[model samples]
Target: MSDLREVAITSDSSGQLWNACVWDPFVGTTLMTYKGGVSNSHCLSFIGRDFLISGDAVKPLLHVWALNRQEQIQVRMVCPGKVGALAISPDGSYCVCGIEEKLHVWQVATGRLMAVIPRHFQRVTCIRFTDDTTHFASASEDGSVIIWPLCKVVSMTQDIFRSISDSAEPRYTFSDHSLAVTNIFIGKGGMRARLVTASLDGTSKIYDLASGIMLLSVVFDVGLTCVTMTIAESRVFLGTIEGKIHPLCLHTPPRSLDYHLTETEKQNVFSEHTKSITCLSVSVDSSMLLSGSLDEQVIIWDVPSMQCLRKLQHKGSITNAFFAIVPMNVFSNNLKPSLVLSSFKRRSDTENEESYCINVLNSERILCDKKSENKESLKYLAGQVLQLKSQVKSLVGANLELYRGLIADVWDGHDDDEPDPSFESTQEVGVHKKRKIKHKKKRNLET
Candidate 1:
């Protein structure tokens, strides 16, 4: 598609030779490619549209890159263990990664460790941050789902001993699944939101976040791998291990404990996948559905027709795919990234400090060597320079105003101070008494 407002992103998830690619889905053309480590399902995240990150399946490292650069950032964050699932807060200030069965939280800007939580008994399968970024959910192979308050998780590290015991305690823990929970999704409205989770137990459960109770449960014959809802919350789409996508209507309220999902074959038009679906996503307007499968194909379906519009066949199993509505110049060259993570530590030690400095210097050297390719690239760079200059001007004006206020206060205080112990207001007691008498005479006249 020629629409610059939205872009299709998918990774060639080979793990070893992985590359993040952007595509023009309608025309079936590759527009851009970002070279770096590959990631699995629930492992890819875009940090505030400035940078992209993914955890390498084979290493305990997270690969990062600026959206303006094709190569991964010189520094990669090494976690305590290999990251299986990763999710960054919507604000991009903090990120929580599921490394094996444990969850690690870190401040993205400073590379500071915030907490270590081992609440899951088995390997984590998915991690998702709520829309408000106030809470996060982690699902695991142990058939448990835990919801953690973002503030409570960080509050532990403020105290030394309390952190040891409190870091692992979550806000809410649900053990409703008899099998491993495959994925979880939280809708809007913060604490009063709704949580939808899919499990391999042939059921998808909905929970009310406010009350911490199961609202409804949908059961099917086949095990579910992933689940998502339409933009309007009209229906829920469940991807099965049997390679079929089931659409469950949500018209009926959650009055019963369980309900069987039913649909006729004539309406089951999204049964094109032949393998277990790994992940699922919907468009911004919910007009299209995107799904990736272990069969190495990413399908784009028209939600209205429930027919496949495009099939993006990959060299490796499709691990992650999603639609992003971004600025028109998001992929433009020579656009400097505003993100800073040079201190994103490997293991939080000083021995690697020198190496990090060297990497930073090397990246700077490469950036300085860049030459504008064409008029369009040059135009974009010039626009960026203008934007920076405007920001600088605004900051300078603000500082000048602050300094003027300080200078005025100093001059006013000096003027109010004693003038060689000869100031009229301080020395003239008779003049003060006359003013007081005038006030008394005015009060007497009023009486």
Candidate 2:
């Protein structure tokens, strides 16, 4: 386990404690630690291989650091308010920073300000890019999901409110959530794509991007702390503060409405973590899963087996985490991606308590530190994500006619004459053709 490395990070607050740290889990090694800021670091992104981008509370700037250089690459200050979230595009050309009330897109390499996309009335919490680089989705504290065209953002800003003129206008807004959206992730597998989101109201919603409709909804007893998707398979993982993890298998084609879970997979709870799970990271290939929790622990589970393989403990509550995968070599399949773990502890808690330190743990020992955050900043960002979701949803709704047009193209043909009865069934649709073929074969064999 010592072969694994560690980096620690911490952020600042008034108490000089509760700051979070990111580090390697094995042997309690430290990698990068950010401490003593006005607000805690809530969002992090790995840009251009070794460069890391992070969003904090008070500093309206997004912190960019060169991981190999172990130094700050640039402090990108663009937003007027606290930088609440950060997301890097797949190509690493564009990075989206979620400011308290606005969103800014910056070029990662040159640190150039590409565009300033104003946020909604509510604060923006999370920003994510679709599998295809053509678009990105954002969630707001207002309980909405806004899908934006990456290519048209700059141009659209010019006539920003054009869609607002008609209140009854059919647009692209998706406002199904009744509460603030805390997390949003786009899942891609096979030929289908899904926008997965979790909210403060203890519900996880899955939306079909092509149709811009809510496809599936799951309610949990506890508020959802985070939601994540893997690339290798169509698994949507949700972490709830109520001490449970729900995994959903994304469906496609004729069975799209069948969102029920198998008996063995329902309420798949892992009780090792004493508290809520805050963040999650899946291996690039989706073979492994890692989770950070308020219980001062990180768990690495075998995705296929759903068995916990490692229990990495921290000195305090874990804040966030990311996996750094090293390219494969001539001898091995691929070097296991090292787990970059982050944690935080309250500074003033009694000395005997574990709340005062951040710990990095891997297969072995845990590293510890005591740092905290300014509570105001955390609340500010959490609230902002909800607000941004609504504004984006409204923006989406403004383009609703466009989405409907797309669906219409698929479902409703231009031919004035209705389709023949034999072809009218859903089985005639291209997506469901294979299922229909299978059913026909079974029926013939039965006869």
Candidate 3:
């Protein structure tokens, strides 16, 4: 009974090599790790639960994997330009790839190029589709959020070539930020979607899609790297480079004096990640929170209890990890610990002093790929892959054991209604404190 999970990661620490690793949580081990000749591999998406899309700056080729099997299976499709970001539709029928200056739309089943969106100031940073699939939006480094009508793009394609069909026209473009936009996310629900975007300018803005008007602008103390909304859309979580979490609620006033800090909801700042925050993921039910950081650590936090679950170790600064939903969630202790996708790069000799050499735990077999001519780089990459595989295998084995324990406990009545000791004793809530605002400086800088 393997508990398989998916985790993806990127390693940019080593300027020379780019690597990606996948951890199968059910099997409790890293099923595969890839490195070498890959310049940049970002914007990963699953095509129909079978293929994985990943590529870099020079190569516009999208590396597709049939997830049904373990190995990197095929190159399903190749785009015209470098893919900077990618997003698959909610229903998994289509996918949008954002290149340096264009957006390409493709059909998931056949890998046919459907359309190309041209003429942008810089690379598209992120792309997302509406729930209905009627429209899609893409963000650029140029500080603009463009919304395209899917019906129009599809209709225009019959007469024109497929590549020129689904262009992301400007439904609304936001240029309020003086700096480049870093991330953008559309809220869940129905029509008139809410667009929340963050940038290098240390500000997060919410937009009304129907009216194309700015709803709220949140100015934080530091630059925000990533932003995500809870499943209920009642709370917004912002992560900063300084390794802090700012939780804001949609129900409260966006700019009131007490808006940022609520009386009942305590502010718990977890300083587990030593470096910059790379990615943040909250479970669908908002019970668990996952943070990947440049410090090469993955910290899982129990949301309601505010206790650290397990500081999962990794080889490189975790590029990203998604809590992918699977069948095991229904019978598991914590459904949030399903799949994690992390990417890492080789480290320099300086970093090796603190980082342990990657080793496979609880397994007798070891990977035989020795260091190449570049001993240092090979050692780092080899260690990274070994560690990733070890973590994946552990997850797979542990998940099966957890499920088996759950069944036995259910039948034996030994663990029923008993809270996990790991969660209860450390449940001390954090206190609330307010930071003095420099209104004059804020006004002076904005002006």
Best by lDDT: 1
Worst 10 residues of 2 by lDDT: 340-349
- Residue-by-residue lDDT tens digits, candidate 1, 228-329: 887677778888897778877778665578887555632574888888988788877888888889888899888888889989888888878877765333
TM-score (C-alpha) between model 2 and the true structure: 0.59
User: lDDT for each of the candidates?
Assistant: 0.78, 0.61, 0.62
Record all residue pairs in model 1 with backbone atoms less than 3 Å apart, i.e. clashing: none
Candidate 3, 216-319: lDDT as tens digits: 88777678777777777777777778877667778964464222344444345656677777677677678777777778777777777667777667656665
Indicate which candidate wins on TM-score.
1
- Over 4 Å off, model 1: 1-4, 15-18, 156-168, 253-255, 263-269, 327-329, 346-447
Candidate 2 lDDT tens digits, 1-447: 232322323332331443344545333445444343333334666654444556655565555544444334444344456777777777666777677656666544444344665545588888888766767887889887888776665332334323211121122567877888888878763114778888988878878777887877776656888888887547778887865677766654344432444466654655567677777777676777777777767777778888887776666666566565422221133323243222111111222333222222256323332332446567789899999999999999979978888988876565656657766665458658788899999999999
lDDT of 1: 0.78
Better of 2 and 3 by TM-score: 3
- The residue-level lDDT of candidate 3 at 217 comes to 84
Error of 2 at 29 (Å): 6.2
Candidate with the larger lDDT of 2 and 3 = 3
